[model samples]
Target: MNKVPITVITGMIGAGKTKISNRLIHGIKGSNCKVQVLVYYPDTITVVEDISTKRQYRKLPHQEQPAKLITTQEQLISEMISYSKEKQPIDELIIELAAGIPPQFFVEELFQSLEKDMLDKTFYIQSIVSVIDAQHFWFDYTSNHYVIYTNDNDRMEHTFAEVMISQIEFCSHIVINKCNFISKESLDETVSFIKKLQPKAQIIFSADGQVASQTFHSVNDVDLHQIKSNIGWKLELKNNSSTLNLVEKFGINSFIYESHSPIQLEKLEEWFRTFPSEILRSAGYLRTYSEAHGLELLYFSQVGASVIIETVDEHCTDTTARSKVVFFGFDLKDVEVTQQLNQCLMENNNINQTVV
Candidate 1:
C-alpha cells in the first residue's frame, strides 16, 4: 500500500550518524516523496543553527535542521502525528536518534503504542540503519570503551558500549564511514570483522556519510509480532531497550563472557582472528596476567569488521584484574566463544573456564 516509510539512522555519538541523516534528507529532495525529519537533540549540546552547513561535498537544496532534538517519547509521537496530519502529504519520515537512545525503541514502542489501524494506514517502518565511525568506533572496540558521556546516557541508563552494540545487533544495514584514516589492510580486517558479526546485515562501506541510491529504497511494512527479533527488539513490553531482556530469536542472542584470570596477548589475538561470524559484537576489558611495560588492562570492543584495543593505565578507576566481555549476535553458541576465550586466559591460573 501507500503507507509512509520511516527510516531511522543510529550509531555511537560522533560516529557520523547525523551526516548520514543529512545525506538521506538531501538525497530525497527531488525524488517526489514528501519527507520530514525528527532528530533527537539533548539539552546540553549546543545546537547548530544549520546542521547541513558543514555538508559541502555536494550541492544540497535548502537542507536545514527541522527542529531542536526530540527529548521525550511523548514529543516524538506528537510531532510525528502532526506530520501525518499535515496538509502537504509526507510519504517518507526520516528519524535520526541521538547516540544514547536506540532507534529500535521509537520504531517498535512508538508504533505499537499507537492505534494499529492508524499506523498501518499512515506509516510503516522502512528500515533501521546504523552508521559506524571508522576510527573512533575502532578505538571504542579496541579500547573496550565508548565515549558515550553522562549527558547523553542521562535519558537512558545504557552504557556507551551497550548503545553502540545494540545498533550493530539490531539494524538491517550498517554504514561504516570515515574510512580514509585506515590502511587497506585494516579496512579488509574491518570488513572481515563485520561479516562475522552480522553475516545477514547488508554492509555498506562509505568514505563519506552518503549511501548509494539503492540503499535508500523503502520497505513495505513492519509487523512486530510476526517479524520477531529481526530488528533486535527484545522485551518490547518494557519502555526501554535493555540487554537484560535480550532473548534468542531471529538468529540473534547475547551472553556475557567473564574471566577472573588475565588473558594471554597472543592467545587473545588468535581468538579475535578466529572470531565467530555468528557473533556480531564483543565489548569489554581484557587483563593481562602480569603487568608489562606499565600496562595491565586493555579495553576491547569489536563490531562486525572492526576491532579496537586501547591500553589502560594501572591507576584507571576500572579494574584490570579480570576480563569481562559481552557478546551479541545471531546463531551464536555461548560454549564455543567461551571455550576459545578460555584458551587465552593465563594457562597456569587453573581457572580455564570462562563464565558465560
Candidate 2:
C-alpha cells in the first residue's frame, strides 16, 4: 500500500528552519509532488506576510521568501491524516514546530495523535528531519528566543542549537541549513558538532532548501526498531540553565520573581497593559484567587497574554513550582521597576477574584 511520509522540521528561532521549509514546500509543489508544510504559531504567519511584502516592495529581491501558515501542532497532524485518507498521492508533509519546544512534546502530542488514528489505517510517520543553523553555533536558545527582540546584542542564547541537537538525536535525517551564511571554518565546525550529536544521521548541505528533488523521491518505510533506537523514550533535559545563559548575553540584567502571595487581578492586568519596554516575555504557573482553588499557567508572548486554566492536582507537593511566575526582558533589571512589581504583588490584598 502506498503511504504518506511525515517529516518533523525543528530548529532554533532565527536558525532558518522556516525559510528552508517554505522553500522546500514551494519547490516540491512546483514539481509533480503534492507537498504541504505546517506551522504552529500565528506569529509566524505575520512574519511571513511581512517578509513577503518586504520582498515584493524590494522588487523581488534575491531571496524570495516563501509563504508560511501557522496552525496548531495537533490540528496540522490531524489534517495530514485526513488528507492521507483521501488517497491523495502526496509526496511530503512537513510539520514545523516553534523553536525551543521539546521534541518529546512533538512525539507525545503529534506523533501519538497520528498513531492513534493509524490504529484503524496504514498512515505512519516516515522520518524526522531537523534543520540546523550554521551561522550561530555558539548561541543559546529558549522558548522565548524571539519573544523579546533586542537591539545591539546579537550573541543572545536561544534554544535553537540545543533543539537542533535534540532533533538530530531522534531523527533519521539532519539538514545543516544556511551553509551559505557561514565560512569554510565555521562549516567544518558545524559538521564536527553534528557528528558528535547524531553520527548516523543522513546529513545534507542545502542551498535555499534546494535538495536536488531526489531527497524526497524515496520514502523510507517506518522502522520501529530504528526509530525507537534513535529516539529515547525517556527525555531528560541536560541543559536547564541555558536560558539563563542566553539572557545573560544581553548584559546579564535578568531576574525571576516568584511569590505565593495573592495578586489583585485587575492591578496585575493593568501593570501588564502598561508594562515597561524592557520586559521581553513572562511565563509561569500562578494561583489566581487562593492557594486552595488551583493554579493556571500564565503565558505572555509578543502577541498577547493568556491564562491556560486546568484543575491543579492538590496531591502534588511542589507548591513552589506552581504558584510562581518569571519575567524576562530588557531593562527589567531596573531597581524601581522590580520594586514596583514586587510592591504590587505584595500590596494587592482585596481583589475581585477571577478564578483562572
**Maximum-TM-score candidate:** 1
> Candidate 1 lDDT, tens digit per residue, 1-356?
47778787887656776677777766777576667777765444331212432223334233344634687667777776776675666767777877666556656776774564375567777677888877665555534333333454472233455566667766677898988878876676666555434445678888877775458576665444433344332222112322332342345456667776777877777777777877666666777644434226777777665677888655444555567776766566877778888887775533324221
Supply every candidate's count of residue pairs whose N, Cα or C atoms clash at under 3 angstroms.
Answer: 18, 9
For model 1, give the 10-residue run with minimal summed lDDT.
233-242
Residue 147 of model 2, lDDT score: 26
1-356 in candidate 2: lDDT tens per residue? 56666666676555566666666666776776777666665332222112322221212222233334655655565666567665654556676766655455565566566667662244456666677766554443222222222235533232333344456666667777768977887677557545534556688887555554346434564454464444311111112121232222233233445556654455666676676665533444454555454434343222123223344455423543424444444445555555665655633434334332
List candidate 1 stretches off by more than 4 Å. 42-68, 143-157, 222-356
Work out the TM-score per prediction.
0.57, 0.49
Best by lDDT: 1
lDDT of 2 at 6: 68
Question: Could you tell me which residue pairs clash in candidate 2?
Answer: 12-160, 140-157, 140-158, 141-158, 141-159, 142-158, 142-159, 278-330, 280-329
For model 2, the local distance difference test gives: 0.51
